[model samples]
Target: MQERLNIVPFVSVDHMMKLVLATGVERFLIELAAYIEEDFRRWECFDKTPRIASHSAEGVIELMPTSDGEAYGFKYVNGHPKNTRFGRQTVTAFGVLADVGNGYPILLTEMTILTALRTAAMSAVAAKYLAPKGARTMAMIGNGAQSEFQAIAFKAILGVDKLRLYDIDPSATARCQKNLAGMGFEITACSSSQEAVEGAEIVTTVTADKQYATILTDNMVGPGIHINAVGGDCPGKTELHRDILLRSDIFVEYPPQTRIEGEIQQLDPDHPVTELWKVITGQVPGRSGGRQITLFDSVGFAIEDFSALRYVRDRLKETGLYEELDLLADPDEPRDLFGMILRAAKPTPVAATVGAL
Candidate 1:
């Protein structure tokens, strides 16, 4: 039997990649979305809060933490848009899950790939509830590492097959197009956000610039569209114009956090926005009318990460893609930790050494 207290299962970047490939990205996303939805249904059971962030001129680093009464989880993530200039990823992360009863870590895993997956899955989940009925097209405003995953998730979850893509850098758009070429999407590369949003029922603005960017103006956002505003995920970072927010009914993961980090930050602190969990649990309406615009102001959240950690923990048993890490000290007696170290320092016995000689 495995000694659960002393060993932590570590899923490295390589193992994460293997697990993702083995699971098939689309299937994994669909499965993860199910888990997210399940957690959202029981939203009141979790301990929730805004991510704690450290800011810098170049980017921001954040720690997202959450817990159910039984288990605890946290993710350390960084967002440095300028890192792309040095050929590095703009966002990277890792996470840990621990037993709340014992305060022992149970799992450690690379969360960079997982974050991309979960973010896309979360967006898809929101879109499924809030998007226009029979919505088939989407405008992907920013083409970064996250763009392809968003495309795949929407395809798997919402049956969206037509994509209109626009990025300020043409190379980024080309990369997104090439990555999604064989994915059965009818993708059109556009020169501007306006061209991309045209004729699309769902408009997703995921730009990377850390400014108050107006990627979508009020006039450009017609009624009856669902806006997935993802990139405006931190204070001082937003994509939609304030006027657009005034015209749309916004749905958020956590209002306290979204008020600080999401596009809703541009609105009045007391402005009304529906909590998505309530919609998922049938406590409130999602898409009320054919002409009402619904906006999912997503800033990512801790419960989503908690759900992801739970999913990964469940997958580890089936895939065996993780390694055992000797992360905790286990002594013959729990209180004799100092004595255990002393005994190890005593070295091999002289009699045993002579017998071997």
Candidate 2:
């Protein structure tokens, strides 16, 4: 065992892809959801706080952090929807999992892909409790980076494989369909959001625009339907109209944060909302009636990211999907860090003869 104090494991984008491929996408989602569920069960044990964010005219950058008494984890993520216009991903992230006892990071990994996976898994976990019994088809309103992962997670968890896809840009829908080809989905590319939700048991609105846009209106949603409102995860940005929010029983990860970032931002600050952890812990009911509309106001939370970090750390040993990194400083003397650094400096070699210029 490499017991170097400064050696932390790093999983780059390539290793993350290899790990996901080796684990299989659906299986990975299932396993990741299990980890999320486990953490939610013990939700009160975590030191929770809303993510720290910095906003600008163009986009927002955020730091999500949390600790479960033993392990500390945080993710640095940025969202700039306009990046897609310039051939860059709208969201990119990397995270670290550290030992709470000594504040030493044990793992660092790229979370751009992991965030997508964890967000999908969190949505699926919420839907499993709140969605109607035996729900099948889903209306995916936003065919962007998060659409396919959401579809696969629902498929792996709740057996939802039928997708009615739509996006303002038809090319994005085409790309989404093409990416998810042969994934055992009965796909229908619709021109309008209304057409997409015509027969959907679950309607997911995941548009990437960084503004208040009603991707789903009051009439677009129906009774007994579950709405996974994934976009609108920031201040001044939302996806659903106010009327739809009025008719739905909203479930959120953190109310203080969601009220400012999620679709419920349209509702009153004191509007009643149930915490997802309470529902997961059986302290509160999820879906009460057949005609009740359930809305998961998913503004990605730190606990979910922590769970994703934990899941990836466990998988590293089995798949060998991480590289060791010298990230710590271990001096011969506990208090001699500076001496260790100076001693390791390159010896002053014979100065190269300066060419007479």
Candidate 3:
């Protein structure tokens, strides 16, 4: 049997929780934002695609995969709004980082909370390019698991102070308010989406339902507002009225993926939209005037997950916070895959030598 050496380290959810607490969520958001922008700047260096999804009556599950010519990664995440009723998180996610050179996994960990952080970070990155200068006071249309992260992201990255919150579920709004209370944000619980959106410079939507629900109509939106559409990340799930998309200058992470999942799903396939990476890379323009409306259709692309995975891996290395896992057998002969496991249990040497006819 061929023997090989591999390194795979894993960090549990508890370690991740400790990492966030030690580094601070704001710092994590800032670092993630920087990494995402850095990766987006080199758009052609990565292999990108839309995520694969499996739908069911309760909710939907997804697999996001991407590669940067050298390294590959993927995440498994589920969105079930009803799960919270049973004391389970509405979303449960796990991801793996792998070496594309040898097609072997290097690390795997839970990403339920990590996904929320990355989604918020991505939204903030788009807002940094598209939102007006000195933009603060955001209106959050849906207050669920994502609301607190969105609030903190905007607050830290964009200097937003005031947040007007609205959600169909009163408990969800209350939960968001309670989580964000100690963070020094000026939170206002609005009775409706329209009330929440009134006079706000940035409007963020992160509802969890798995259907087409109009959280923001065109008439409710005013001029010069930057919309961060977060929850409408799957096919047939949308949050904005079609008219709002028709009136705004739409921006997206990846056009090919966003076309099938973002708020622009309501627009014609031929409708014009700007890729946010182009703006970050100076290949395109962002907001040109204070009177212009900007929309960021964030569908949580695989490249963002790629960036997040790399960031987490690096952090674990820096802090020495991971455990080594024996996921794959390293057989010295790369071609002798079958003998590696068999010999591990029984220390018998293989009979056939490689290339011995």
Give the alpha carbon lDDT tens digit for every residue of 1-357 in model 1: 255566899999999999999999999999999999999999999999889999998899999999988999999999998998899988999999999999999999999999999999999999999999889999999998889999999999999999999999999999999988888999999999999999999999888988899999888999899999999999999999999999899999999999999998888899999999999999999999989999999999999998999999999988999999878876556798896677667744642232223
Estimate, for each residue in 1-357, the C-alpha lDDT of model 2 and write its tens digit: 356776899999999999999999999999999999999999989998899999887788999999999999999999887897899988999999999999999999999999999999999999999999899899999998899999999999999989999999999899999999999999999999999999899999999878889898898888999999999799888999999999999999988899889988888899999999999999999999999999999999999999999999998888888998877777656698786667667422321111111
Residue 34 accuracy (lDDT) in model 1? 97
True-vs-predicted CA distance for residue 70, candidate 2, Å = 0.3
Give stretches of model 2 more than 4 Å off: 346-357
Q: TM-score of predicted model 3?
A: 0.92
Scored against the true structure, residue 18 in model 1 reaches a CA lDDT of 98
By summed lDDT, the worst window of 10 consecutive residues in model 3 runs over: 348-357
CA shift at 352, candidate 2, in angstroms? 26
On a 0 to 1 TM-score scale, where does candidate 2 land against the true structure? 0.96
| Candidate 3 residue-wise lDDT, 1-357, digit = tens | 112245577778887888788889999999998888999998899887778889898888999899988889999988787887899998899899898998888778778778888989999999999998998889998887788999998988999999999999888889999989889899999999989998899999989888899999879999998999998988889999999999899998888888998888888898999988899989889998988999998888888888888899889767877777656655657687787666666665453232121
TM-score of each: 0.96, 0.96, 0.92
